[model samples]
Target: MTAPEWIELQLQLPREQCELAEELLLALEASSVTLEDGADQPLLEPAIGERPLWDLVIVKGLFAGDVATAPIEAALAAELPRAPLQQRWVPLDNRDWSQEWKRYFEPIQCGQRLWICPSWMAPPQPDAVNLILDPGLAFGTGSHPTTHLCLRWLEQLPLTGATVIDYGCGSGILGIAALLLGAERVIAVDNDPLALTATADNADNNQIAPERIATYLPEHLPADSGADIVLANILAEPLIQLADTLVALLKPRGQLCLSGLLDSQLEAVTRPYQRAVAFQPPAIEQGWVQIAGTLRG
Candidate 1:
């Protein structure tokens, strides 16, 4: 069967205006909207929870080929009068759009001992602890600094025989990595059903024993048990809000690793946990920071 083509309407505007453009495009019946750096800016490594973009961004909206471009252009002009909108209409060739982005996601090395490789690719370092993963509807492929921060911390920990709770376990990357690194058991928890599915699928792909890894929704987590380590790679706001709950999930003197925070947000995120845990200096990478600490005994 032949694939259906699409018409992509794009506008070059300041980064601040990209969101508005995306919303306008969606209202105009665009099937999807994406933003890219118009100035070809290098985003080597973005801060945890940061959606890094260039000062100038190109907002692209996709629509069925039959949709008229005139209305979209007219709406942009009317709604975003101040935006120096340089618009273009391009025909997006029919192809597997979902898998096309995979080309850009090569194997990523998180730490000295860990490597995250797409299922289709061969491991660059055969001896390393390779994590077979792919970008999916859920996050965490070891490409994001936040995930890398958590993976690096997991690699350094004495996970052998340890029990872990991967709170907010997007893609289940942290929990899976823990299991592969010799953690006896991991309880993966996430509110998103898609995330739970991805984590389970990835765990199966890795041939991890079903008994070694368990998946649960937030409310379904076993209340009677606590873990030797707790890892949460969610944004700073939620990290602060869930500080008590996360701490309660850990055993006394158990370790906690928190990522998905910008360097500037370090103090605010850490403040909520300080009364109960003693944090070590944060691990900073590309403007992102990971906070790891031990609960007070």
Candidate 2:
């Protein structure tokens, strides 16, 4: 196993220049170039509705040489006007991260009551509420602040035998947690085929009752069936688009938990929801916000 030498090239450009930057990078034959908002930084203070700002990330495999850098620089010069660009080198080893990061995935206690444990980890003391989970590709390990906030809110709610709709059900963590928290049944929704398959595998791993869980994709969400709780942890843009659908899936007075949004993104994400339900200030962690509210009757 060889150590992986990595380089992260970060550049900030006007939002308007995003496409041009992407086009230029592709012309340079860079792989997996990512676009992000500098505003995504925690504690980033920016004006509301500010546009024309974006961050471009171009990563090159180590063997890529000075020849690559020259072309990339020329491309950037042609596209972006003297903006901020950063390039840094990182040293990494071949030790499998699957095992390295796996150690951090132990049983987590949330809301003074709920316990989320990987199937391979020992359950908390019997008196404590336990929810079994296995890592999946999508998201929500109960470790991220957004998920933790949701778990805490779940403890404070009365979900005894209530049906739930777990949107963007990554790792099936939230849905499985809901069941262990006393939801009668949960319908987990995610568009990723792998996520859906993992959800089923996780449900089986936890020995959830045969009829206790059902999983589906976004396009397949049943129009008429609603739930007592709607839990979604995707980012803001998608959440706003799904606003009407999410509200529609909630029975009158049904509850909703929205997460995976940064503090900077809260206003955009919460606007539509606020029109339908009164919500409290979000639970904040590491600059991410998770909001909970009850749907209007």
Candidate 3:
């Protein structure tokens, strides 16, 4: 059978004008809008209650195959700061999007002993420490370089009977991996309640006992709680901002692993904790940095 057609109107615009262009596209009845980095640039995460964009962004508006383009372009020209610096129309094949993601997200091995596998697929190596993950829009399927970096770190650690905290526990990926690799306890914490739910559900999916892993909103985690390891796979700014909070969760000489920052931001992110923690050299993958350290006894 032939696939239904679709139109992608792609425009390159400055960061300041990207939001306006997106609004204009939606106003023009585009089905969906996507924004991408136009120039190879350092990436930053959105701060709470704030939106950040690349210096140069490529915005693509998807429309029905038969939608008229001339009127949309006219509208953009009138409403935007200026005409898009570059523009083009690309043909698209409409497919069953529900199953489309499955094609690309197969089993991924982060280290010799660990694999992140979707629940529906067989593990690439059954005897390996396989994490059965079915992400529900929270985050962390091990595809992001930051997640991969963390997963590898978890795999190599001596986690038996360790108490671990997964701060910013998106989809509970890191925490669950810790449990599967033999950690005795994990405290999974996140600001988003949905993330906590995903974390709890994922832990259950892995056949973890309800008592083995605890999920919490940041405010609800006990102040006295301490762990042998704390993994914070959140962005750079949050890592810096939460330096004191993260440190307080560690036992004496406990390990602290952090990722989700670019290589350039490592020094700044580490400065807040450097005085008390002896950090190992950072692990780099795809330009993302992961730093692990031990709290001084």
Candidate 4:
């Protein structure tokens, strides 16, 4: 089948001019806009206090194939008078948008026993524990190193009949994994409603009981009654801020697994919870760290 083509305008502009450039493109009826480093700088996910972009940025915008470029250039010239700009129009061939991710997101095995299988792919090991998850807008697919750290920790934990709280649960992957590994039930919490919905849908897709996984917004979460295991795979700043809240959700001598932090930020993230959690040496993967330990009474 033939792919649809869009006209993409690539604008090489100073980082400071990106904001005006994006606004101008959007106003010019560009369907979407994206940015890349014009100098070939390697970009990582932005973290607390981290710089996200390069000094020279290539701001690319996509428009309908028939859309005229004259107005776009005119708007750029008028709006960003002082900033130097280089622009080019290119044909952007769009492939099967629906199947694009499948090429990269195949089945992933986190640990010895757990296999994260995409819905369309059969589990490599029928006898092994398999999590049927399809990639979505929500995070966590056993892809990110942070998620891998958390999943591996969960896989190794003694979770049979244990209760778990998946703090900041993205796609419910961590919680669903706990259940698959014999957790009795799970409380999945996230700030985004879309994440909550995805978690619930994924839970159902995994054939977990409707009542086994409870989804809630942070404010809507039940009072912290505590659980045998608490898993939080969120950013370092939030982990530090929510240290007390998360600790309060841990039962006496309960286990806690924390990720979504860099090896550099590990000390700061562990400081708040240090007094309460008897943390073991952190596990590092691809510059990401997982801080896991038992909560003190």
Best by lDDT: 3
Best by TM-score: 4
- Which lDDT value does model 3 have at 282? 96
Candidate 2 worst ten-residue window by lDDT? 57-66
Tens digits of lDDT, candidate 1, 160-246: 999999998889999999998889999999989889999999999999988888889988888886999999999889999999899
- Pick by TM-score: 2 or 4, better one: 4
Task: Report how far residue 115 has shifted in candidate 3, in Å.
Answer: 0.5
TM-score of predicted model 4? 0.76
TM-score each candidate: 0.73, 0.67, 0.73, 0.76
Off by over 4 Å in 4: 1-35, 48-98
**Model 2 agreement with the true structure over 177-224: per-residue lDDT tens digits:** 788888899999998878888888887877788599999988887777
Q: Report lDDT (CA) for all predictions.
A: 0.87, 0.74, 0.89, 0.87
Error of 2 at 277 (Å): 1.1
> What residue pairs clash in candidate 4, if any at all?
none
Arranged by lDDT, best first: 3, 4, 1, 2
lDDT tens string, model 3, 1-297?
553477789999999899889988888987778888899887764432235688999999888777788988888888997888899988777763234447878888988899999999989899998999975668889988889999998999989999999999989999999999999999999999998999999989999998999998999999899999999999889999999999999999999999989888999999999987899999998788999999988
Off by over 4 Å in 3: 1-97
Predict model 2's lDDT versus the native. Answer: 0.74
